[model samples]
Target: MQIEVLNSQASDINTIFQFYDMAVEHQKKVFNKHWQGFSKALIETEIAEHRQYKILVDDKVACIFAVTFNDKLIWGDRDKDSVYIHRIVTHPNYRGYSFVKEIIKWGKLFAPMNGIKFIRMDTWADNDKLLEYYTSCGFSFAGTVTMEQTEGLPKHYEGISLNLFEIEVNEVAASM
Candidate 1:
């Protein structure tokens, strides 16, 4: 399979939303909480800022995700030094392909090149499966935090406790 990672464009909004809807359906089946959906403006802004990304398998979108330079509401003081990953949605056809691992590999390279110190992501604190999966993918379980301030954030983040995962850029680079 030919795989390519590239920044998403505004025109891909419909496909992105399809993947997100599928993800939410999957989440509803497996978890107690599911994404409440993201605003069109929010996603459009990410696309315009080049913070949205997609992985394509032979030109078909297999996965999509967003990144932010800072996430003070969740990471607090440690936010600025990291690249925060959010809303990873993989197409059903690509479910078993280990795309999250690919994203991490991408982040390891993308971070330092952008002068970032760490690659960080978060999931529901109660998601034991994902916590284990992220650790297996080379992230350290940084801990859990209960979100106190969710203003301007997605609805899913409101009043939720999240499990933080991080991989230092230098650590990955040194090992490589």
Candidate 2:
């Protein structure tokens, strides 16, 4: 398996949406609340910004995710040397393969390559499965935060308490 940046010029946008929609349905079943599906324009912007990425297995996109150097909206005022991970969606065909582990392994390397010292991710505070899964990946449970302002963030962030996870770059890389 290989991880690569998403190429806007060559990638299929609809395929990305299909994955998101599928993930939404799956999340609904697992967590009872699904992510608010993103807009095509938002995705296009992410692609143009080179923040989207894909993991390929046998020439097929197995999973997709996005990253940002700073998530001021979520992490607000935290001065941590970290890269923020968001929206990890795995193709239904690729389920049961533990893509989060793969993403974490990849993120362990990817963060340092970009000169970052920490890897951070956040999700709904009530999502215990996700918090546990990330902790198993070596992320430390930082705590829960109910952001006072989430004006420009995704709909899910509106009036929500998010669980924070942080993995020191060295911690993840050493284990890997």
Candidate 3:
């Protein structure tokens, strides 16, 4: 398993395209706007801007995860201490491999090293499976967000609400 930050320019857009297609086929299963920000071009832009991160195993992409240090939620900030995990997806074919937990563990360690003390993530309010997954991975439900999506890709997803979860990297590490 090799986990490193792939530059957007270095990222393979084809992988994202394939993942986007699978995500769209089972949008409800994951509780995210599958076609929203992860389309080919958008992902490329995000990668180019260094707002996204990915994990690959055996030369096969296993997960897509992104973070923004500038956006501070309830816990920490770029200058303070938090990393907000935005998008995370495991290839559908790679499901049931327990790699999700590995990814979280990696974040707990990596975020702090990058000056982020807490790791925050959110999912659609209706995605119970994801909610459960996060909880089991040691994230605590913090709150809900009902942001207005009047512009950009968010605009394409109208009236969608997301549930937030967070876990302090230090705390998770100590517990481990």
Candidate 4:
């Protein structure tokens, strides 16, 4: 099977939303909290800016994710030198493929090329399984933070505590 990563396009919006909805349904079955859904405009902007990405296996979309250069509200001052990953959703057919590790491998190359110092991501603070999974995928737990200012963030982030995870760009190469 051939695997490729590419920026998402406007035509892929419906598929992306479908994946997100599926993810939320899965979350409802396994976790206490689930995504509240993202705004269409926000996604459109990410697409326009080339921040949205998808992994295709044999020309079919298998996973989707977004990346941002800034996440000051969740990360505070440390956000400046990092690329924040968000909204990772894998299609059910590809469930056991370990795509998060692929994203990390992609980030290792993407980060330094963009002059980023670290790759960062966040998940529900109480998600022990994800914490362990992310750690196993190469991230170090950077502690948790309760979001105080969620004005521009997704509704799910409001009044919630998130566990942060990060991998320094330099460390990625060393680990490999």
Q: Which candidate is the best by lDDT?
A: 4
Residue-level lDDT tens digits of model 2 in 48-131: 888777877776888888877888877877846888888988888878778777767777877777777878899889888888
**How far off is model 2, as Cα RMSD?**
2.4
Superposition error at 38 for model 4 (Å): 1.0
C-alpha TM-scores of all predictions? 0.96, 0.89, 0.76, 0.96
CA-lDDT, candidates in order = 0.91, 0.79, 0.65, 0.93
Worst 10 residues of 4 by lDDT: 167-176
* lDDT tens readout by residue for model 1, 1-176: 88888999989999999989999999999999999999999999999999999999999999999999989999998887788999999998899888888898888878777888899999999999999999998999998999999998999999899999998889657346
Off by over 4 Å in 1: 171-175
Whole-model lDDT, model 2: 0.79
The positional error of residue 97 in candidate 4, measured at the CA in angstroms, is 0.7
What is the TM-score of candidate 2? 0.89
Candidate 3 per-residue C-alpha lDDT over 24-111 given as tens digits, one digit per residue, 9 for 90 to 100:
6677464445545445566766778777666676767876766766543323222246667765667876777666576567677677
Ordered list by lDDT, greatest first: 4, 1, 2, 3
Supply every candidate's count of residue pairs whose N, Cα or C atoms clash at under 3 angstroms: 0, 0, 2, 0
**Off by more than 4 A, model 3:** 1-11, 28-34, 37-41, 72-80, 149-153, 171-176
Predictions: Cα RMSD each = 1.3, 2.4, 3.8, 1.4
Pitting candidate 2 against candidate 4, the one with the higher TM-score is 4
